[model samples]
Target: MLDDQLKSQLAAYLERVTQPFEMVASLDDGETSAQMRELLTTIQSLRSDKISLRTDGQDARKPSFTLQRVGAGTSLRFAGLPLGHEFTSLVLALLWTGGHPPKVEQDLIEQVRSLDGDFNFEVYMSLTCHNCPDVVQALSLMAVLNPKVKTTVIEGGAFQQEVTEREIMAVPMVYLNGQVFGAGRMELAEIVAKLDTGAARREAAKLSAKEAFDVLIVGGGPAGAAAAVYAARKGIRTGVAAERFGGQVNDTLDIENYISIPRTEGPQFAAALQQHVNAYDVDVMNLQRAKALRPASQSGGLIEVEMDNGAVLKSKTVILSTGARWRNMNVPGEEQYRTKGVAYCPHCDGPLYKGKRVAVIGGGNSGVEAAIDLAGVVAHVTVFEFMPQLKADAVLQKKLASLPNVDVVLNAQTTEVLGDGSKVNALAYKDRATGEEKRVELEGIFVQIGLLPNTDWLMGTVELSKFGEIVIDAKGQTSVPGVFAAGDCTTVPYKQIVIAAGAGATAALSAFDHLIRTSVPQ
Candidate 1:
């Protein structure tokens, strides 16, 4: 099933295998089963001595495989073809199961091994999802580390019945012990923190003990990474505290607009950004969210930034690049039905509604693009625009119109999401031109209206615009001296990746300038 180049790459990766492992397949007589067998056979052919494939297994799924270490009772399972975005997850699982050391921190490894619960994880994922691989890899690594923990990565497209039964309308829906655990992208640390319970207390204690920093950046998107790199280059004590490193960039699918780079995926670019920042002396604290910001009482005084875990971080200067998130439809059922039938990401969750009708609640570039992409996989896509006309570019509008299964309705405002107390069955809207309400039956609603700045935490701490975005001057300095803001969270007109990176650099430089002109609080 793999191409020659892919086979060669797999062969090279498999060379690191020091121990033997077996791939036990439980497949029926079907096309997908045949493909699964071919994939397993090809993998075994690469390292014949280290790997073995068997089809005499009985898994619940018709086409599934379990990778088990020879003597160690550790194992992980894949219920469908681990291709597309999950291919890396599959490869990592192979190497990790075959005794190749994972790139995770030694502390995290030890913690996983020390966990006492009988954890069984099931991750429902889509192959097109850019965010699924991280979760899959994390859970898989957990399963490999602790024999008590068992994980099964299920490809939603290949297991549509189970997905429907579970009411999973989104990718990367994680379940622990048959109950919903989490949905969306998650890091290894985040997962472990949830399971360990005391992890947050330990982390808070560790963070509280750290010394003051010269430049402490809050956020880990493009802007935060750039700020960290620039600040670290100045030879100052630099630190970054982020809720999730890469931030919203991880949810983005395709990013062709990044200058210099012709085309690259969002996860790929985010990884590159992390790698670039890691090259510097920046101390990155991932999975730590900023809850409050306290500006220094006097110039050159240390600014105190409080985290969600009650850990207060003091720094000479703080850069707020917390960024923005997808604006949600404020309708009644929208929040209640999230992940059940309401989803924000079309590229990631489109396959879940294959051959089913869905609605896009905006006529902007993102909305139209989502409609265009969903038309290929879904039965029909209806674009709803609150304005009289679409705001998307002429080229995108033209492309959207050309799609046979896509329809656009202008002057329509989404009112409420309709559901059966479990999953969304329809959407309520108002026809602004006619002053009448309307409802459309559908399996999903993709909200792509816009973004809301993540500056709610800085409400009483700094000056904010009417829309809650951080107000900044040309130098990227906030209302508070030595406190700077950048990226989507600020009053920047454009929210492009390139613009955020540039703004980050500007904020860092401005923070440095503020440091030299003011006296250090004695």
Candidate 2:
């Protein structure tokens, strides 16, 4: 009973409404492969009622649902991916198909509508990581809000080989316009700022003083190096300020485990990592220290850094990776015997003491772990604990007790380290009980006391935890908005080299996201 004109109009409406639904259904197949076929069939059967589709088939029945498209112009986007917490995304996708405008905060929505350039976004995430979901949601919302933006979510497991090939060891990483963003969860405001302003791309460029970079990372330790590499790889103008280039890695004797690289020596491994950064054209300012960071309130903002030789450098963003120095035992002969017989980090120096007797000082978990680790590499390991009993975990105590080459001396404290000019020869100790005094002959002494964060120079710029470590959120963001912190300097629990590297990557990506959101007009 429909006229030709009416049928033509209905056909156009059906096509407009059904095209986006079909595309969304296709995506669902990938998201839930097993249930996709059945779900699609059921949804399609209800399409007539769900949508006001006028059909002439003899099997026509009452439609089950209605379709209301939202959003106007070419700025339409799917708010959710229809996966996990993305249920709302499905609704938004349908709304986009109907050529209607979405309801968003008036001011923010207006700003988004004004964007005109191409914005490419890709978020990297791992299945096991807890913080990735939040980051994914934030990114999805950004893509939905801006019509000029196209977003993709990459599963870490699916790209495991690629990630390993690129030496990517972090989760919740966001890459926009080839520049990396957050390694973990970040605030929406920060992400928007980075994207809008092109700050991240500028940060990745590695521009010279004549054309200063947006970001300059100081130090070449695991943290610093990671930041530099990530920033530069993202096409940001980035540079590194390092003293002696490799930082603490030069002093490392061996690196048994650092995620991808299972076994490596400190210097050689550090050199390889540096080469990776260099490959990406990151500028390396060797033998330099950023003595101070003074902020400049310019258009892009600038940080004036005073180098050691009174040379001043300027940049838009500054990353402080000036790692901490080992707190040496101030006992007179201790300084003279360093490397010869005194060492820190038993895992790095244990091999050198093989088949030789060694003394481990301190009673913390690190001391106990070192003692246990050294027992396997040395002829004998003597642990000197000032406490009445070992302060390590009960499990560690049991393990150490089981080791035939390990011995624990309770209520004993090292008074001085005595050594021949060439090497450490022995240690003088006093026992609290019975006022007992003893001297033990050993080839090496491992100090496993603890670590101090390198935040002394930071003053009050950022919040510091009770232990002086920088306080950062899951995304490596400090209390300050523009500034971020990572690695051992931050309050993240694990202090392994891999963890630090991951943190550094996260910080750089988060900073990039901030830059992007700020660069664009919206």
Candidate 3:
């Protein structure tokens, strides 16, 4: 069950086990149980005398083994076999329990320490997910730091019943206080904020009393950040409220088409945007989701921006740069296996599947583009489209046709995602015409159907296109006076990062112009 090279790596990692570590399990007569024992034995042999595993010590919750620091109720446990991407999770839990706490934000540590009651965090992961480890490590660290918090890292494959019951479609599905927190790649703070501790509600109440602003930009993605910077440069009272900045770009993996910069990740670029906004006098309020918008008094008066948190801000002018989010297929296994074999941005997760077979779930421009780009890196590429013909531009379709490793399947509806509890290994689709189900075996699935503007809140408040995109004119002015919009959230024709940034600057200039011409001197 173990190899020489892997054993060597495990041995080197265990050298840092400054303190004794133990794995307690209750193994009976079964293949899974027997295999679990063998895997543990192999690991123990590799670590020499530093690590130990006991098969018949105790059974606290069914047939399971608990991992903890020698004697303490470390509150870190593993329910199933820790293999695949979770192998690193097991290693991290051991390392931290042995006394090496990761260097994280002081605020994060405090949040963990300030817990009022016992909290159980369950992070479900697959062996092949690249983004699962971070969630696992984060929750595990939180458990280790706070005695009131315990974390169970479950390998999605090891426990099929729980996966089905929980409707886990994506990996790294976090459960906080026994409720589904979030799925896919998510920051710890994002997950933690979802906890109903009354603190968030209180923060919302506080924001409800915000003062009027010269310019208040909603949506904190690239457009919002750029607008904030430009507005603040004018030395005006500029405020930016967003659920999270960087918008759809946050969902993007690798961003190489941002003009001058050759390459940068989505999160990295977002951080840079935040830093730029911070350099100015902009009032940056993150994690504040806009819930409603309307003119404070008259059609041209200060616009009232109501937040989902119950806080409100009044500004003379507002810029809507809420941006857009990836349109999910909403099929089974799509969410549970995300970052596992299921992926969205080819640019970001493509490198993870080098030399492996993958599938593109749409035949549109983005889907075809992803297939073309991935073909050069992966061993093979398959494109599945529900339509009878590819919707990609003629140029892109021609490019795809020329790729030797790429193949397209028209009129195919993705029926389901097939995986082995840990990672996706195949996709099931039905031929639209024949209604016959077909399955394609591959390592990765990229869904690029299209984008959905994050403008649901603006529903009737502002003029919107039939597709829900905010409509804006050449000067970034929306149908509503004293309001402007930019980036993917608007009908701006394009949705690239550079375009969004430029749009943001334009919207800010317009808002500044509106402020100078209309607002009374302070």
Segments in model 1 whose C-alpha atoms lie over 4 Å from true places: 298-300, 520-522
TM-score of 3: 0.69
lDDT of 1: 0.93
Best by TM-score: 1
- Per-model TM-score, in order, reads 0.99, 0.50, 0.69
Which residue pairs come into collision in candidate 1?
none
Best-to-worst order by TM-score is 1, 3, 2
Off by over 4 Å in 3: 1-109, 125-141, 152-169, 175-181, 298-300, 328-359, 369-382, 386-406, 411-446, 520-522
User: Candidate 2: where is the Cα deviation over 4 Å?
Assistant: 1-210, 244-268, 297-300, 330-333, 336-341, 345-357, 363-380, 386-405, 419-426, 430-443, 460-462, 479-481, 517-522
Q: Which candidate is the best by lDDT?
A: 1
- lDDT score at residue 390, model 2, on the 0-100 scale: 82
lDDT tens per residue, model 3, 147-188 = 888888877666766766675545767887798767666655
Q: How do all the candidates rank in terms of lDDT, highest first?
A: 1, 3, 2
| Selected candidate, larger lDDT, 1 vs 2 | 1
> Candidate 2, overall lDDT?
0.63
Provide the clash count, candidate 3: 12
